[model samples]
Target chain A: MRPSATAYIYIAPAFALLLFVLFSPVIYGFWFTLFRIEYGAPTDFIGLGNYVRLIEDPTLLPTLSRSGVFTAACVVFTIIIAMALAVWINRLPARTAFIVQMVVIVPWIISAVVATLLFRWVFVNDIGVASYIIQLMGFDAVQPLNNPTGAMVLLVAVSVWKRIGYAVLVLLAGLKSIPDDYDEAARIDGANNWQIFRMITLPLLKTPLLLIAIVLTLSTFNTVETPLVMTGGGPGDATRILAMDVYERAFTNYDLGSATALAIIMFAGNILLVMSYVRLARWQA
Target chain B: MSTITLSSAARARATGRHFVPRLSWLWSGLFGCLVILNIAPLIWGILTSFKGQADLFRFPPAFVSFTPTLENYERVFLSGFGGNLGISLVNALAAVVLALVLGLPAAYAFDRFNFPLRRLLFLAVVASIPLSIGAAALLIPNYVYFASLGLTNTPIVLPMLYAAHQLPMAIWVIKGTIEGIPRELDEAATADGCTTFQILRYVILPLVRPALGAAAILVFVGSWNEFVASSVMVDSPSLRTVQPAIYSFIGFFGREWGPLTASATLAILPILIIFALFGRLMVSGLTKGSVKG
Candidate 1:
C-alpha cells in the first residue's frame, strides 16, 4: 500500500533529521575506524591494522569474558527471580498483588545514576548496612566495590534489582493472559501446582519469556553506569566489561582507532544476537 | 467415579497440609524482605542528604540526623550548580517536545495509511537504538562533525541528540496507540467531509491522549536521566546536565556525600512526583504498547 504524496511530505522532516543525527555519526564512525587519527591531526589510512591490534590487545579477551559473565549472570538471575515473584504475586488476592507490584515497579523509575549512587553508599565497607550485618554474623568484612568477585556480584545484584521490575511486570502480563480455566482443569485432574505451572503456564509463556530473555540480554550486555560508578572496573580489572573498556580506550586513553574498531565488533556481535533472536521468534511463531 | 475416588484420595493424602501454608508464609516473608532491601538504599540516601557533612560520614551511619540543615540544598542552588539543573530541565523538556513534534505526525501517518516502505521505515527507526549510546566510539566523529557545523558544546546539541535517540521509541509507542483506535472513526470523519489533518485533529488525537501523555512522561524521564551523550557532547560547566554536575562530588579526595546526596534528591524529585501521579497510566501504556507493537 502506498501513501499519498502529502503524507510522504509530512514525514520527510523526521526522515531527514534522523538521517543526519542518527545515521550520519554511525556511518562516520565506521569510516573513522579504518584510519589512524588523533585528537588534532590528519587521518592516515591504516587499513586493517587497527582491527588487528584490537584482536591482539591483551585486555580484550578478559574484558569480553567479564562482559559475558556479567550479562549471563544478570539475565539468569533477573528472569528466575522476576518470574518467581510474578507467579507468587499472581497467586495472591488482587489488592495484595497490586500493592506488591507497585513496590517492585518503583525502583525502575529512579534514574540509573541515582540508583548507582544509592547502591554505592549501600555497599560502602564500614558504613553500609550489608557490611555491618555481615560483620555481625561473624564473617570477615567485605568491601564489595574493592574485590573483583564481590564487585561483579554487586553489579549483577544492582542490575537485577533495578531491572527485575520490568521483567516481573512483563511476566505478570503474560501470566494474566493465561486463562484460569486451564489451571482449574489441571487441578481437577490431580496435577500438583508445580506440575500445572511447568506444563501449562511456562509453555504458554513462550513468547513473553523469549522477549524478556532477549531484551534483558541486550540491555545487560550494553550496561555501563553500574560498573562505572560502583567499581570503576577496579581490583585488577576484574569487573571491567567491554563497554567500560571501550569508554576507557576512547576517552581515557584516547585510542580512537582501536576504540572504534572494538565498538564495531561489539555492534556486530549485538546484530548477530538480535538476528538469532528473530529467527527463534520466527520458529516459535 | 474413578476421578472422584482419586480426588478424595488426594485430599486425604493432602491432610498434612501444614507445609503448604508454611511455604506460603515463607514466600510472603521473602517478598516482604526484598521490598525492604530494595527501598533501604534510597531511604539511606534521603537520610544522608538531610544530614550535615560531619554526620554524613559518622561511623555506625546515623539513622536519624540530629540537626538537619538546608545548607546543601542552598549550595546546590546558589553555588553555580543550579545552572546545570536549568540546563537539564531545558534540554529534557525541549527534546521531548521536539520528539513529539516529529514523531506524532509520522506515527499518525503510519497508523492511518499503508505507505510504501512503511515496514522499512519502521525498521530503520527501531535500528537507531543501538546507535544511541556508547558515545565514546562516536565522540571523535561527532566532535569533528559538530566542529565543522559550529554546534559543539552548545545547548542546542543536547536536545538534538536526545530527540534523535528518543524518536524511534516515541514513534513506535504513538503509532501503537493510534492504531488501536478503530478505523471506523476515521472513515466517519472522512465521510463528514473532514480532510486528513482535520480527521487526525478531531478524531485521532483525542482518542490517543493517554498514550501521548505516557510517551511525553517517558521521554521526559529518559532525557532527564541521560548521561553519556550529554557528558561527551557538552563540556561547558554551565551547560552540563545534572548527572555530570553530581559527579563533581567525587573529587580526588574521597567524596562530598552531603552535597551529592542532596543534589541527587533534588534531581529525582520531579520524576518521582510525575510517577506518583501518573504511574498506572504510564505502566499500562508502556506494557500494552510494547506487547502490541
Candidate 2:
C-alpha cells in the first residue's frame, strides 16, 4: 500500500476515539446551549435565551470579574516569579540550578486538590503554621481563610505557589534558547547589565514569554479545582470565579442551560488562547 | 531523550544570568524564602499526617516535636481509600497503555508521511491538549455528551476519556522525538528489504523509547490527577477516583486534619516519586508537548 493510504489506516483508531470524546462534544455542547436541556434531553428550543440570561444575571458578572481578578493575579505572579527563578537558574552552577528547580517543582507536580489541601493546612485557623508564626512575631493572628478579601488573596497566593514551578520550567526553556553572544556583543559596545537585559535579552525572550502567558491564562481562568477544594466559593462568593460559577449553575443549581452557556463563553476564550499558542508554538518548532 | 533536561545548564552562557544584580545576600535570601515557600506546605502536611489528633489543635504546630503515629493512615486505609487508590491506579495505567497503542502509529505516520488533511488532523490533536486540561470548560460539554450516550457512571468511561484526552499530547511528544531520530535509519532499514512494520518495531520503537516513557508518565499523571470530570461523571462509591475521593473527604472529615492530611500524603506519594525519578524527562516532555503542566 502507498504511504498516504496507510497513513489513514494508521490514524483511524485514534481519530475515531478523539472525534467522539473531544470533537463531538464541542458540536454537542454548542447545540446543547441553544436549548433548555432537561434530564439528558432538550425539552425546549431556547436559542440565546440561556446566553441572554447569563449576561443579565446578577451573580455571573461578579463571578466573571472575580475570575478576571484571579487570572490576572495568577498570570502576573507566575510570570514574574518564574522569570526570576529561570534567570537565576541560568546563572547558577548546573547542580544548584537543578536543586532549585526540584525544590520548586514538588508542589506544582501534585494534584490541584491535593495541593490545595496542603496549602490550606498552612493557613488554617488555630493550628495553621502562618497563624502560629504570626503570633510568635508579636502580631495579631490573621485568619485569611475566614475573611472575604483575605480568602481571595490566600487563594491567589496558593495558585501562584502551585503554578510557579511549571512557569519557571517553560521560562527557563525560553531563557536557555538565548545565546551569550548578544550580551557579550552589547557589553563590547559599552552596554551595562541593565541595558543588555532591557535591549538584548528581553526582546529575544518575548515569544516564549507571550506563549507562557497564554498558557497560564488559560489554566488559571478556567480552573475549578483549587477554589472548589479550598474555599468552595465561600466567604460569601468572594472567590467564585467563572469556572466555579459554571459548576454551581450546572451541578448545584441543576440549571444546565445557564451552565452550558457560560461554558461556551469560556471555551471561546480558550480557543483564542489556543490559536495564539499554536501560532507562537510553530514559530519556535 | 525523556530524561534530558529541556536544555543543559552547562550550555552556552545566558545573557539573562545577571538578572538578580550585585547583592549575593539579596538573591540568596530570596532563594531561601522561595525554598521555604514551596517546601514548607509539603513538609507540614507530612508532619501533620504523623501527628496525633491532639497535636493538631496544639497552640504551636509542632514540626518534628510531635510524637508520630500512623493512625491516620490506618484510618484512611480502613475507611476504603484503598479502593479509591486502586481505581485510580487502574484508570491511570489503562489510560497510559491505551494512549501508546493508539498514538504511536499515528505519530509515526504524522512524521513520516505526506498525506492529505494531515495538518488539519494534527491541528485537531494539538488543540485538544489544553482543552482537556482546563476542566471548567470541558466538564459540562463532556458530561452532557456522555449522559446523552448513557456512558456516564461507568468504569470504562473515565479511562476512555482520559486516553482520548492524553492522546494528542502523546502523539506530539512521540512524533517530535521521532522527527529528531535520523530519517536515514528508516531508509537504511527499508533498503535491506524490511517491511514498514519491521522497521517500526525494530528501529523506530527502540529509538523513540524514551519519548514513549515520557509520554506514559505524562498520561499517567494526567489520568491520575483528573478530578473535575471524574467527580461529575462517576457517582458510584466503588468507582470513585482518588482526587474526587479526597475532595469528598473534606465533607467526611471536616476540620479534621489527621486523616485528611494522611490521605493527601498517600495520594501524592506515587506521583512525587515518579516526578523525582523522571523530573528531567517530564520537564522535557511537558514543555515539548508544550500544552500541559
Candidate 3:
C-alpha cells in the first residue's frame, strides 16, 4: 500500500468508531428532536414543536438561567481558589510543596459520584460535618441543601472542590515555567508583592488562565453528577441545571421529543459559551 | 559602594534559589487550611465508614473513641454489592482497552500522515470533547436505539459508550505525546525499509508508552467514575456499575450511614490505588493533554 493508503488503513478503526458511535448518534439525536415520539413510537413529525416548547415551557428559562448562574459561579470561584492555592504552592519549600500538591490531588482523582456522596454526608443537616462545624461556632445547624440558594451554593462548592486540583496543577505548571528573574528583578526595583503580581505575574499568566477558564467553564456546564447525586435538582428546581434537566426529562418524564429539544438547546448553549469565551479572550488579547 | 550593592544582590539571589517570591507563613497556613478542607470530606467519609451505625448520629458526630465495626462490610457484601464492584472493574478495564485500541492509531496517523482535512479532523476530535455530552443528551435516543436491538441492560453497552466518551481524550493525549517524538525517527525507519504499519508497531508504539499508560489510567478512572450514562443505559440490577450501585445504597439502605459510606469507600479505594501508583504520569499526561491545544 502507498504510505497514504497505509495511513488510512491504520486510522480506519478509530475514525470508524468515532463516526458511528459519536457523530452518528449526535446527528441522529438532532434529527430525533424534530419529531414527537409517543409511547415508544414516532407519532408525529412535529418539526420544531419540541424546540418551541423550549420557549413555551415554564421551567425552561429558569433552568437555563440557573445553569448559567451555577456555571459562572463555579468557574469564577474555582479559578480564584485554585489560583490562590497555586500561588501558595508555588511558595512552599520544595518537599513540602510537592507533598501538598499531591495531597490536594486526591479529590480530583476520586470519582465524582463518590465525592458527591461524601459531601452529601458531610452536609446532612445536623449530623453532617459542615453543620457540626456550624454548631461548634455557636450557630444554628443549617441544612445547606434544604433551600434553593443553599443548594445552589453547595453544588457550586462541590463542583469547585472536585475541579480545584486540576486548575491548581495547571496554573502551578504555568507558574513554575516563569523564569525567576522577572520576580527578582521586580523585587530589586522596589516592587511590593501585590505590585509584582499585578505587573509581572498576572500578565504572563494569561495563557494558562484562559485555558483553565475554558476547561472549567465547559466542565462545570456539562456537570450532571454533582447535581444529580447531591441535590437531585432539589429545593424546587433551584439546582436543576441543564444537564440534570435533560436527564430528568428523558428518564423521569419519558418525554423524548422535549428531552432531545432541550438537549439540543443545551448543546447549542454550550457551544456558544465556549466560542464566546474564546472570542472574549482573543478580543482582550 | 555600587560594587558592594551588586555583591549583596548576588548573594541575595543565591540565597533565594528556591524563592517563590513573597510567600509568607500566613499564606502557607491559609493554603494548608484549604488543603485540609479539600480532603476533609473524604477523610470524614473514610472515618464514618469505620464507625458503628450508632456512632454516626451521636450528638456532634463522633470524631473519636468509637469501636470500628466489620458489620458495614458484612452488610454491603450481603446486599450483593460485590457483584456490582466486579461489573465496574470489568467495565472500566474494557473501556480502557477499547479506548487505547481505537485511539493509538488515530494519534499515530495524525502525527505521521500529511493527510487532507487533517486540521479539520483534529478539530473534530477536540470538538468531540464537549460533544461527549451527547452521552447524556442521546440517553433517550440511545435507549430507543439499543432497546430495539436488545442491547439495553447488557454489560457491554455501558463500556462501549464509555469508551466512546473517552476515545477523544485518548486520541488527543496520545497525539500530543507522539508529536513530541522527532519526525527524523520515522524517516530513519522508512530508510530501513520498514513499512508504515511496521514503523508504528515497532518504533512509534515503543516511544509513546508513557502516554499510553497515562491514557489508559485516565480512561479506566473515568469509566469507573461515570454515573449518568451508566444509570440511564443499564436497568438490570446485575449489570449496574459501581456509581449507580452506590446510588442504590441511598434508596435501599436509606439512613444506614455505615454500610452506605462503607460502600462508597470501597468504590473509591481501587481508583485511589491506581492513581497513587501512576500519580506522576497521570498528572503529567492530564496537564499535557489539556494545555496542549
Candidate 4:
C-alpha cells in the first residue's frame, strides 16, 4: 500500500471514534436543540424555539452570570496563588522544592469527588473543622455551602484549591525553562529583586501564564463536580454554574431540548475562550 | 565599625548572593505553610475517616489524642462500596486501553506521514483536549442515543465515553513524544527493508513507551474520577462508580459521617498511591504537552 494509504489506515480507527462519538454527538445535540424533545424523543420541530427559550429563560442569565463570576474568581485566584507558589518554589533549594511539590500536588491528583467530600466535611456547620475554628474565634460558624454568596465563594475556592497545584507546576516549569542568566545579567546591571521580576521575569512568563490561564479557565468553566457535590447547586442556585445547570435541566427536569441548548451555549463559550487563547498564544509566540 | 563593614562589603563583593541564603529560608517556610494548606483537607479527611462518629462531632475537632477506630472502614466495606470501587477501576482501565489502542496509531500517523487534511485532523484532536465527554450537553445526546440503542446502564458505555474523552490527550501527548524521535530512524529501518508496521512496532513504540505510560495514567485517573456521565448514564446500583456511590451517601441518608469519610478514603486511596509513585511522570507528561503545544 502507498504510505499515504497506510497513514489513512492508521488514522481510521481514531477518526471513526472521534467522528461518531465526539463530533457527531455534539452536532446531533445541536440538532436536538432545534426540536422539542419529550420522553427521550423529539416530538415537534421547534426550529430555534429552544435557543429563543434560552435567551428568555429567567434562570439562565443569572446562572451564566454566576458561572462567569465563579470562573473569573477561580481563574484569577488560582493563577495568582499558583504564580506566587511557583515563584516561591523556584527560589527553594532543589530538594525541598521536590518535597513541597509532592505535598502540594496531592489535591490535584485526588479526584474532585474526594476533594469535594473533604471540603464539605471541613466546612460543615457546627461539627466541621473550619466552622469550629470560626466559632472558637468568636465568629458565627458560617457553613460556606449553605449561603448564597458564600456558596459561590466556597465553590471558587475549592475549584482553585483543586487546580492550583497543576498551575503551579506548569508555571514553575515555565520559570525553570527561563535561564538563570537572564536574572543574573539583570542583577549585574544593577536591577533590584522586584525590578528584575517585573522587567525580566513577567514578560518571559506570558506564554505559560496564558497557557495556564486558558487551561484553568476551561477547567473552571466546565467544572460540574464541585458545585454538584459540594453545594448540590444549593442556596437557591446561587452556585449553580452552567455545567450544573445543564445537568439539572437534563436529568432533573428531563428537558433534553433545554439541556442540549444550554450545552451548545456552553460549548460556544468554550470555543470563544479557546479561540482567543489561540490568537494570544500565536501573537506571543 | 561602619568603615570596617563598608570595606568588608567591598572586599567580599557581595552581589546579592549572601542575601539570598537568609531569604531562602523564609520563602521555604512560607511555601511549607502553603503546602500544608494545600493538603490539609485530605489530611483532615483521612483523620475523619479514622474517627468515631462522636469524635468527628467534637467542638474544636480533635487533631489527635482521640482513640481511632476501624469501624468506619468496616461499615464502608460491609455496605458493598467495594463493588463500586471495582466498577471505577474497571471503567478507568478499560478507558485507558481503548484510548491507547485508538490514539497511539493516530498520533504516529500524524507525526510520521503527510496526509490530506492531517493538520486539520490534528488540530481537531488538539481542540478536543478541553472537550469532555461528561459535559451535560453531550451527555444528554449520548443518553438519548445510547438509550435508544439499549446501551444505557450497560458497562461498556462509560468506558467508551471515557475513551472518547481521553483520546484527544492521548493523541497529543503521544504525538509530542513521537515528534521527538528522529525521523532518520524510520528512514534507516525502511532502507533495511523493514515494513512500516515493523518499524512502528519494533522501534518507535519502544522509544515512546514512557510518554505512552504517562498518557495511560492520566487517562485512567480522569476516567476513574468521572462523575457526571456515570451518574446520568447508569441507573442500576450495580453499575455505580465510587464517586456516585459516595455522592449517594449525602442528604437523604443524613450524612453518616464515619462511613462517608471512610468510603471516600477508600475510593481515593488507589489514586493517592498512584500519584505518590508516578507523580513525576504525571507532571512531566502534562508539562511535555503544554510546552510543546
Computed on alpha carbons, the lDDT of every model, listed in order, comes to: 0.76, 0.85, 0.81, 0.81
Question: Whose lDDT is higher: candidate 1's or candidate 3's?
Answer: 3
In what order do the candidates fall by DockQ, top score first?
2, 4, 1, 3
Q: Which stretches in model 2 have alpha-carbon errors above 4 Å?
A: A1-3, A283-285, B1-22, B291-293
**Per-residue lDDT tens digits of candidate 2, residues A1-285?**
135677887889999999888778878998988888786578888898889988999887788788999999999998888877777778888898888888887787799999999999887556789888889999987777789998899889989998898888877777778888877889899787668778887898887788778878988988889999889998989988998888888888998888888888888889888887776766211
Candidate 3, residue A146: CA error in Å? 2.3
Q: Per-residue lDDT for B102-159 in model 1, tens only?
A: 8888888776776677767766655554345333345455655665577878879989
Going through the candidates in order, the fraction of native interface contacts each one reproduces equals: 0.34, 0.64, 0.49, 0.56
Residues B85-199 of candidate 4 have per-residue lDDT tens digits of 9999999999999999898888888888887777677777766765652254467676766776788899998999889888887888898888789888998898899988898
Task: Order the candidates by lDDT, highest first.
Answer: 2, 4, 3, 1
Score residue B16 of candidate 2 by CA lDDT. Answer: 39
Best lDDT among the predictions, by candidate number: 2
Who wins the DockQ comparison?
2
Q: Between which residue pairs do clashes occur in model 4?
A: none
Candidate 2 docking band: medium
Rank by TM-score (best first): 2, 4, 1, 3
Which pairs, if any, clash in model 2?
A: B2-B281
- Superposed model 3: Cα runs more than 4 Å off: A1-3, A273-285, B1-23, B133-135, B148-150
Error of 4 at A143 (Å): 3.0
